[model samples]
Target: MTAICIKCGAKKSFPYNKCGECAFDPQLAREDLVKSVCLSSGRYGSQFEKEKYDDELNSYSAQLRSGLSVEYDQEEIERLDMQLTEVEELDDKPIFKYLLRVFLPGILLLLFLIGVLVVLKWR
Candidate 1:
């Protein structure tokens, strides 16, 4: 069987990674994976690139969990996992969501009740 090189589209032998043109090394790839995970936003050049890197990591993790023949350094994988968790935690929802969804509705309801009471007092 054959697998497409991650760096290049060339089809190559499975478990080998990369093609003759790309000259990919497993250790170097592992280092890059760790770097990609450790860097903050835009480290890969743009938000799209960063998301692509995350998607690649997630896909590889799924492959490993699915028992694919592909292999990577276990230590590197562990480090990547930790870095991903940290990044996710840092991406918590913005405060605007709370203000828009919860605070605004409550504030509007309070104003409506106040208006009703003012009309009753006038009567």
Candidate 2:
């Protein structure tokens, strides 16, 4: 079996991550995969890149089971946790239509009063 090298498109032997021609260590290789994350919008990145990133991570095979620390920020993770906790209430709109209805009458009344005053002054 053969696996394709992601950095340089070349067919290489499997099981052994290091290329015969280019010695690319899997640990160091992961840093390159970080680029797949499109942090611009802080949302999901290119699906194709994300797929490739997952594939490359899986390519290590054994590494997944043992666990690896990609060194994700603890603060950022906590912030995301807080965000997830708040996510449930995100859908619930706080605006009450009654407030607008009440406000509209007051505004209309003020405008009518001003309009009456303006006409009286004009006369």
Candidate 3:
């Protein structure tokens, strides 16, 4: 059966072949688009690049909410919102802050283990 692809609005054999326009499978159109956009917008970039990505994300979100194509999937919309929030939050944090948050715990744990090993060896 041919149906309109929710992501690209192309008429194709639904649930079988991918959309020729966006290369998205009809069964998972929304998911494919959302994942593609989120993956393309990685966490690290220049300030100007991040701002550009933020604008793109906002545009996609608005398009989804605008109901231009098919009925919007609430779950997908929420996922996009969460991703947007995460991207914005990461953009605000400094590189040092991010590095510390990611690696400080491991460093502290290694120090504690070394201290324990030293005490054991002396004993």
Candidate 4:
């Protein structure tokens, strides 16, 4: 009987066996999950990048949780949950900070141009 591999969604001979498509083994799911979590938790260039990482982590957690016959370590899943929470917290920066960072340079340039115009007008 063929069953779907939870990690890669590929058809395998059995639910508990190693996946041929992605080489995902139920026996090593915990290690893979930890590795994925560690990889996802890193410095991101922008909010979009962080959000993408968050999505990847979420999908990985879901896949592990939905496995047909695989048993994941509860403590490991809890740790992943904590890491996901941290990632989410990092993603939720105040909009005011982002806006200021993006527009400060333009605002400064506009002020400098206006100052130059005012001085020229006086002359």
Candidate 5:
């Protein structure tokens, strides 16, 4: 039986609501998006690139919300959103930034004081 693919609005012999391009493959697309956004650690080389990525993500989210494509599953979209949030949170933190800023100086000061005390004891 021939039917229309709800995603691309194309007629096909397949019984599924989605065409081959939209055939329950949102996971792959989501993975690509996550990789692009997360792997960069929020360090977009330029403002334009960052805006482009953000626009792409927002468009995908909108498409999922609008149900324009049969492959646009709501549950998957929610999961992707959660993952993006996690990535953003991770990007907000720099490695050892807090430790360096808050503790390194204090530790150095303590070591210096201890060295001075040992020198005085040797006198």
Candidate 6:
């Protein structure tokens, strides 16, 4: 079956593995481009030029990762973070102070009342 591009609504065939135009998936192409860039990273003239190339490559890589994330998946994040040089681990602890803000007090009061009634009945 021919797969259609959901974003652009373009009909595409995979007989030879891609559409002839637009290239459709920016994310997939970005991977190949990164590999070629990394291979040529040390070929720059000056230290400044090398740093500039590396910075631009890093930004492009970040953009590629962000752009490709169409869904939130914890396992996918852990997998990606395992190999990435830069990733901040987020704190998972709850921010709110746990005040007894609901029915706990009411439940305790009812329990006390029931106990008092049972004690009076025993007398």
| Best candidate, lDDT | 4
Error of 5 at 54 (Å): 18
| Alpha-carbon deviation at 47 in model 3, angstroms | 28
Give a tens-digit lDDT track for model 3, residues 1-123.
223334644444333456687676633554644444332334324767666655555555455445654445567557775776687678868887989999999999999999999999999
Q: State the number of backbone clashes in model 4.
A: 0
lDDT of each: 0.53, 0.45, 0.56, 0.59, 0.51, 0.42
Which prediction has more favorable TM-score, 3 or 4?
Answer: 4
Q: What is the C-alpha RMSD of each candidate to the true structure, in Å?
A: 12.4, 15.5, 14.1, 13.8, 13.8, 14.1
Candidate 4 residue lDDT tens string, 44-82:
447777667666545554565566334555675577657
Least lDDT summed over 10 consecutive residues: which range in candidate 4? 35-44
lDDT of 4: 0.59
Q: How does model 1 score by TM-score?
A: 0.26
Stretches off by above 4 angstroms in model 1 are: 1-93
Residue-wise lDDT of candidate 5 within 3-116, one digit each (tens)?
Answer: 333333333343222346555422345454443233221434576776665554445445644667434445655665686778777885776687688999999999999999
Candidate 2: worst-modelled 10 consecutive residues by lDDT? 35-44
Per-residue C-alpha lDDT of model 1 across residues 1-123, encoded as one tens digit per residue: 323444433334442343465675433655544533332222345667666655555565456445563455567557666765687567775666766897888899999999999999999
> Where does candidate 5 have its weakest 10-residue lDDT segment?
34-43
- Candidate 3 regions exceeding 4 Å error are 1-68, 95-123
lDDT of 2 by residue, 1-123 (tens): 334333433344442255454555433533332221211112224766555544544444334234432334456455544554476356443455657776989999999999999999999
Per-residue error for 53 in candidate 1, Å, reads 18
Q: TM-scores for all candidates?
A: 0.26, 0.28, 0.26, 0.28, 0.28, 0.25
